[model samples]
Target: MTTVTLSGVGAAMPQPGDAPSSLEWLIYQSATAALVDAGLTRAELDGVVIAASDQVDGRAISSMLTSGPAGAYLNEEINVASSPAHALVTAYLQILSGTHERLLVSSWGKASETAGGSIQAAERLSVEPFYERDGGLSALAATALQASAHRAAAPDRARAEAAAAAVAARNHADGMTPADVLASPLVAWPLRALECPRETDAAFSIVVERSGRAGSEGISLDGAGWCTDSGRVAERDLVGLPHLARAAADAYERAGVRDAAAEVGDWQLHDYSPDAELLAYAPLGLCAPEEALELALAGAQPVNRGGGSLRGEAPFGGPLRKVVDAVSQLRAGAGVERAVAQIAGGFAGQFQTVLVIGRQA
Candidate 1:
C-alpha cells in the first residue's frame, strides 16, 4: 500500500490576556508553526485542508477566514468545518487518491470571544435540532442523559466518575483535582463543571507526507482513518456507539493491530464530555461496557494521556491537538510500540473519527 508520513507539526493559540487575534491571524500562526516543525516553508506547501466548527467561528464558512493565511499559494485547498480529525481523514484520502502528496492540515477555534454557553451553542443544528437545539439541550445535558443510561447498564457511578476524573486530572496540563471536579457545580444531573471540556481559543497545524520521504525529525505519518454514526438521538441507542466501534475496527485493521486493548501503547481518546469518554471505552474495545472503571483504577492503560480537551478546553481544536499529542507520544517514545487517537462530534451520538499511528513501517 502507498503510505503517508507526517513530516511536520505545530500549534499556536492567542497569547493569554492579549487582544485575541483575528481568525486570519490564528490561521497564520498555526500554519507557520506547522511549516517550521516540518522544516518546510510556505514556498513548499501545495495543499491546505482546514477543519473547524462554524458555530465556534460564528461564521457561515469558517474557511473563508483562513484562505490568505493558510499558504495555499493558489494551489489545491479544501476545508471542512467539522473536527480536525475529520479534516485529517479528508486530507489523507486526497493524498492517497493522488490529488496531493504534501498535505497541510490546520484547525482553529476561539470559544472565548462568543457567548460561550458551550451547551446551547456548541452542537450541530442540521442533525439534532429538536432534542439538542430546539429543546435547549446543552452538550452536558445530552452527555448526562447518555451517562445516566450507561450507569444503569453498569451500576458503578461513583467509581466510573472517579476514574474519569482521575484520567482528566492526571493528563491535563494543569493537573486539576478530583475535589475541583466534585466542587465545580453540576451542569446536568451527575455531570459537573470539571467533567466537561473547558472552552479556550486555540489552533493546530500538521503536515502529513507520503512514504519514501521523511520530516526534518524523521517522523512518519504511517496510517489514519475517521468514521461516523447516525444522528437522531431518538433513533439510536444512547448508551453506546457502534459507529466508533466500526471506526476503531477499521483503523486497527489498517494499522495492523490485532488486539487494541493489548497491543496499543498510549491513547488520546476524545473526552469532550465525561459521558462521551465513558461511552467510548466499550466502543473502542479498550474495555468492556462496565469494566472501564476497574481498568481505569488498575491504570492498565494511560488514556487521555495528554489531558484531552477537558483540560485544554479548546473544543474545535481538540481533535487536532489530540493528533498532535499522539504524534508527540510516538516521536518521544512515550507509547507502547504504537498509539491511537480518536475524535468524535455531532449531536445525538453521531459522527466519529479514529486515527491509529504506529512506530513501525
Candidate 2:
C-alpha cells in the first residue's frame, strides 16, 4: 500500500453579505490558494475530487459548473454528493491505488443563496416519503428526536445541559453560560437555538499527494472508514450511534490505534448539534456515553479546539474543513501528533465516516 499525505489546505469562509464574490469565485479562490500553498502548479495535478450538492448549490448537475473552478479542467474528475470528508476518502483511495500521484479535493456550500425554509423543505424530503415525511420529520426534528433520546439516557439533565452550554461557550466570542443557553428559544423540543450550528457560506480545498512524491513532508492520512445505517429513524439506536462506532473501530484498527483517548491528541467531531458531539464521544472511543458530559465539562480531551461547527458550519464543506484544521494543527507543531476527524451524512446522522491522520507514518 502507498502512503498518502495532505500537502496543503485552503478555505474561504465569508459571512453572508460579507463578500460580493459568487460561489464559483469562492471555489476558485480556495483551489488556487491550495495549489499555491502546496507550491505546485495546477498543471501538475493528477485529478480533482469534489463534494457538492445540486440542491444546495441551487443548480442541477452543479459539478459541471464547479469542476473548472476547482482546477479540474481537462483532468480526471469525480464528485461525491455526500459530505466533503467522503470526497477526501475517495481521493485517498485513488492515491493509494497508484492511479493518481497528486489530487486536489474541493468542497463548498452557499447557504446564502438558499432560503431557510427552502433548505428545511429539502431536508424534510430526505426522509422516507412513505412514513417519516408524513410524520413531519425534518433534519431539525430528527436531531431533536436524537437529543430527546440523549436527554432521557442522561443521568442528570441539568448537568448535561450545563456541559453542553460549556461546550458552546468555548466558541462564542462573548461567552455564554448555562443560563444563557437555557434562556435561548427552543428550536426543537429538546435543542436550544444556541446548541445548534449556524449555517454559513464557505469553501475548502486540499492538496493530497502520495508520500515522497511532493518533495515536501506533509501530514499522513493513516486510516479511514465509513458506514451508513438503516434510513428508518425508528430502527436506529439513537443514543449509541452504532454506525459511527463501527466506522471509528474500523479506522482505529487500520491505524493500529489501541487506545484512542491516549494516542489521538486532537479530535474534530461534527457538532451539528451539541448533543451530536456528545453522542460521538463514546463511539470514537474517547469516553463512555454516560461520561461524555463530564468529560466535556472537565475539558479532559482536545476535542474541537477549532470550535467545531458551533462557530460556523458549511453544510457541504464543514467536514472537509475539519480535516484541513487537523492537518494545519499537525503541521504547525501544535503539540498534536495525531488527530481524528469525523463526519456524518443523511437525515438524523444516518451515515458516518472517520479519518485518522498523524504527523508521522
Candidate 3:
C-alpha cells in the first residue's frame, strides 16, 4: 500500500458580508497558499478534488465555476457534493491506485452569499417531500430531535450541559456557563442559540501526495473511513450514532489502532451541536456515551482543540478545516503522535467520515 501524506494546508476566513472578494478568489488564495506550503507548484500537481454545495454556492453546477480557481486548470478534476473530508478520502484512494501522485483537495462555503431563508430551504429539501419535508423538518429541528432523544436516553441533563459549556469555553475566549447556554434563546425544543454553531464564510485547501513524492516530510494519512446511514431520518439510531461507530471501526482497523482512547491524543470533531459532539464519544471509541460528558467536564478527553464547529462552521468546508487543524497539530509537535479528525454530513448527521493522522516517524 502506498502511504499518503498531507503535505500542506491553507485557509481563508472572511467575515460574512465583510469581505468584497468573490468566492472564487477565496478558493484561489487557499489553493495557492497550500501549494506554496507544500513547496509545489500548479505545474507539478496531478489533479484536484473539490467539495462544494450548489445550493450554498447559490449556483447550479457551481464546481464548473470554482474548479479553475482550485488549481484545476487543464488537469483532472473531481467534485464531491458531500463533506469536504470525503474529498480527502477520494484523493487518498486515488493516490493509492498509483494513477495520481499528487492531488489538491479544496472546499468552501460562503454562507454570507446565500439569500435569507434560502439556506433553511436547502436543508428542508434534503428530506423526502411527501413526509419529512412537509412536517417542517429542517436540520436544526432534526438535530434538536436527536438531542432530545439523547437526553432521554441518558437522563443527565446537567452533566450534558456542563460538558457543552466546557467545549464552548475551550473554543471561545469568553466561554458560556451552563446557565448562560441555557438562557440563550431556544431555537428548537432543546437546542439553544449558544449551543448551535454560527455560520461563517470560509475556505480550506489541502495538498496530498504519495509519501516521498513531495520530498517534504508531512503528517501521515494513516487511515480513513466513512459511512452513510439510511436517508430516512426516522430509520436512524439517533442517539447511538451507529454510522459513526462503523466508520470509526473501519478507520481504526486500517490504522491498526486497537485502543483509540489510549493511542490517539487529539480529537477534531465536527460538532454540529453540543449534543452531537457528546453523541460521538462511544461511536469513536473515545468513551461511553454516558461517560462522555463526565470525561469532558473533567478535562480528560482532548477533543476539539481548534474550537470545532462551535467557533465557526463553513457548511461543507467545516470537515476539511478539521483535517487541516489535525495536520497542523501533528506538524507542530502537539505532544501527540496520533490524532483523529471526524466529520458529519447530510441531515441529522447521516454521513460520517473519520481520518486518523500520525506524526511522521
lDDT of each: 0.72, 0.84, 0.84
Candidate 3, residue 71: CA error in Å? 1.1
TM-score between candidate 3 and the true structure: 0.96
Model 3, C-alpha of 215: deviation from truth (Å): 3.9
Worst 10 residues of 3 by lDDT: 167-176
Better of 1 and 3 by TM-score: 3
lDDT of 1 at 59: 73
Cα-lDDT of candidate 2? 0.84
**Tens-place lDDT digits, model 2, residues 1-361:** 5778888888988864574778899999899998888888899998999998887888989999999999998999999887787899999889888889999999998777785667777777777777667898877788888888887889998887777777766644255666787789999988888887777778999998998864546688889989988989888998899999999998999888999999999898877777888889999999877789988888667887767777777766666788888887788786789999898877778889999999974
Please write out the lDDT profile of model 1 over residues 70-127, one tens digit for every residue: 7776877787766777788888888788767787888877766675474255553553
Please estimate how well model 1 matches the true structure, expressed as its whole-model Cα lDDT: 0.72
